[model samples]
Target: MKAKLTDAFVKNITPPASGRLDIVDETTPGLVLRVMASGVKSWSIRYRPKGRKQLRESYGTYPSTSLSDARARAKALTAAASVGRDLVSEEAAAAAAKAEEEAKAKTIADVVADYIKAHVAKTRKAGVTEKLFANHIVPVLGKKTVGELRRADVVELLDSLKNKGWRTNAQVNRVHAALKACLNWAVEREYLDANPAAVVKKQVTERPRDRVLSDGELKAIWEATDVRTDPSRAFIRLLILTGARRDEIRCMTWSEIDLEKGIWTLPKARNKGHRDHVVPLSNEVKAILEALPRLGECVITTDGKIPYAGQKSLKESLDKAVGASNWEHWTLHDFRRTVTTGMSALGVREEHRERALNHAVGGIGNKVYDRHAYLDEKRAALQAWADRVMLIVDTSGPQNVVAFEAS
Candidate 1:
C-alpha cells in the first residue's frame, strides 16, 4: 500500500497473515514502514547507490521515529544514495569502530581491580593496599577511564582527604603511592598512556611520625579503656602492653597462642616482616587472653566466627571516654610507639626493643644469622612496659607500681 505516512495511518496498520506489512510513503521515494507479524513496527530506508547493491538503513522504531522523522531521514538517505554513498555500510563501519573502542576502554576502577589481582594480591602488604584503595581512591576516580584521569584529579583527592581530616599526610602518601603503582601498571599494559598520579606532588611532605603519647595522655587512655566493653579494652591494652601491630592483635587467633608456653607465635604469612615471629606473652597479656571467651578462631571476636573489624566506632567511643580535648591526634598504632619509647626510657636495650616490635633490623648479619629469638629479653621488656602502663592507669602512684628488673 502507498500513501502519505501519518501517525493515525501507521497506528491503524496491522500485521499480515504470515509476512510483514510494508507501507511506502509517497512523499519520500524508497521510504518504507515495516510491520512485523509479531506486531512490531519500524521505519527504514531502502536505497541502491548508482553502481551498488540494494541496502536498507533503519531510522528507528514506530512511535519513537515519528512520520516526520522517518520522512526526513529517508530523504537524506535517498539523496546520499543518488550521490553513490552507501549509508548503511558507512553507519555499520562506524558502529563497529565505536564498539571496538568501548571494548578496549578501562575505567580507573577496572585498572585498580586488575592491579590488585595481578600484583598486590601476591604481596604481604595486600591488606594494607586493599584498604588504601577502598577507603580513598575508589570513591573519587573509580568511574573515570584510565586514559581520561588527570593530575588535578589525583591532587584533589589527596587534598580532600587531608582537608577533611580523614587521614594523615603519611596515610595520604601511601594512597598516592598505590594510585601511582596502579596507573604505572596500566601504562605498562598499554591501557593508559601515562600515569597522572606520577606527576602529582604530595600535598604535604610526610615526616616520620614521632608522636608518642605523653604520660598524662597514656593515663587518660588507660582510664578510658576501663569504660569500653570486653574486646575493645582488651584490644587497646594489648597494643600498649605487647607493642604488636594493630592488625596482628585484631586478627589474633587462639591457635596462634600457647597458654602453656606463654607465647603468641605469629605465622610468616601474617607478619609484615614475612618471617615467623614469636611474641612472648607477659603476665599482663596472658591475663587478658585468659579472660577472653574462646571465640571460634579469633581471640578478640564479638560473633565467635570472625575477628572484630569496627575499629572506627571503637576509637570514637574511646575518644568520648577519654574526653577528646585531653588527647591530641593519637591513633592505635601510636600505642605501639608509646610502648617502644617507654621501653627505651626504662633502659631496655635497642636490639631488645626492636625485637619486641618485630622490626627486621637492617644488615645481612642481623637478617640471615640472628637465630636467637630473644625470648627472655622480649619477656622482660614487655613486663616492664606492662608494669608502667598499669602504674599509669592505677593513678594510685607508689603502691600500684610493680618492680621489674630492666633488660
Candidate 2:
C-alpha cells in the first residue's frame, strides 16, 4: 500500500545525475530511494548521519547489483541497528576515523622518510647513501609497511639475493639500520612497539681488497690519462690528488674550489658525513684544478649540467688501463683504500684518517655517547695525505709505499 515494500516493486523515479543509480532495502521503515530527476537509478539505503536528521547512503547502481543481495544487506544492517548497534553510518564512520589515526602512528617507510628529511643536507652531498637506497633500498622495500615487517622478511629478502648474498647482506644491513633509526625515532615519539631491526643479527663476511697502484702503474695511468683529449683526463688527475669520493669529485663546480684559499668547500648537501666538509688543496691538486674548464656552470660539463653518467667513462678507461697493467681483481674503490693505506704509512692517526675519508664509523665507544665528527683536523690530514700521494706518484720506484694494514 505505502509504495509496495517487496523486492519485485517497480522503480518510480530517476536520479538527476548522469551516472547510474539503484534502489535497495534496509531494516529501516519509510527510508526508500526517491531517485532523482536524472535517467539513472542508484540503490541507496536511508539512514541517519551523526547529529543529522536523515540522509540517503548510496550503496551501488542497479543491473550491476542483484535484488537478493540488496535484501540480504538490508537485513544485516537492520539486525545490527535492532541490537542497539548504532547504524553503519555513524559506527563505521567512527571506526574508519580511528583506523586512519592509527595509520598515522608511523610505519618503517614513514620513519625512513623522516630520517631522510632530517638529513637532507648530508644525503645531498654524499650521494652514496641516497644512491644505495634509490638503486636498491626503495626498489626492494619502499612499499612495505614498516610496522608489518618482521625479522623473517629481512632474512628472506637477503636470501633471495642468491649469488649476490654478500653484497645483499651489506646493503640489506644498511637498509636495516635505516629502518632501525626510523623505529627508534617512532619510539621517541611514542609511536612504535619497538625497533624490529634491533633483534635482527646480520651475517658478517670479510672482503679483503688489495688495489694500490705501483710506481710504474701510476705513471702509465698518468701518462695515458694526460694524453687523452677529454677534460676528464685532468679531472682524473684531480681525483688521484684529492682522494675524495667519486660523487664528491664528480659533482664539483667552479664555485666550490678556491685556489687562493687552498680550499674547496663541499656543501652540506653532498657530504656523506652530514657535515660541511672542507678540503685543503695540495700542489698537485692545484695543477689539476687549474687545468679544468671554468666555463658554463659545472667544472666538467659543456652544457653546464652535472653528468647524468657519474663516472662510467672514467671507470671504463680505468678498467682498460688495469687490463693493460695485467692487474686483476682490483677496482676503483681500491684507490680510496690506497689513500687510507698510504696515509697510515705516512703517520696519520686513526681518527684523523677516518675523518679525511669522511667515513661514518661506529664502535663500542661512539654508541656510549654522541660525538660530533672530527671535521677540522680531518681537513688538514686529508691535505697532508694528498701531498704524500703526490710525492709517492712522483717517486714511484720499487717499494710499495701505499701500504695499509687492514682491519
Off by over 4 Å in 2: 1-127, 140-143, 165-169, 186-192, 206-211, 227-231, 266-278, 324-328, 343-407
lDDT of 2 at 138: 62
Which candidate number has the best TM-score?
Answer: 1
Would you estimate the TM-scores of all the predictions? 0.69, 0.55
lDDT tens readout by residue for model 2, 96-206: 777655755455456566666676335453355556556655666667665576777666655554347452245556655655655576666544556666786764453
Model 1: per-residue Cα lDDT over 1-407, one tens digit each = 88887789898887887788888888789899989998889988889887988888878998887888888888878788999997777888999777556634778888889899999999877877998998789989889887578889999898888887754567778888899998888778767667788988876786777789988888887788877777888998898888898889998999999999999999988888888999999888999999999968989889779878889998888888778765577788888888889988888888888998899788999989979889998888888888888777785656333343454
Q: What CA RMSD would you report for each candidate?
A: 12.3, 12.2
TM-score of 1: 0.69
Model 1 / residue 113 / CA error / Å: 1.9
Cα lDDT of candidate 1 equals 0.84
TM-score of 2: 0.55
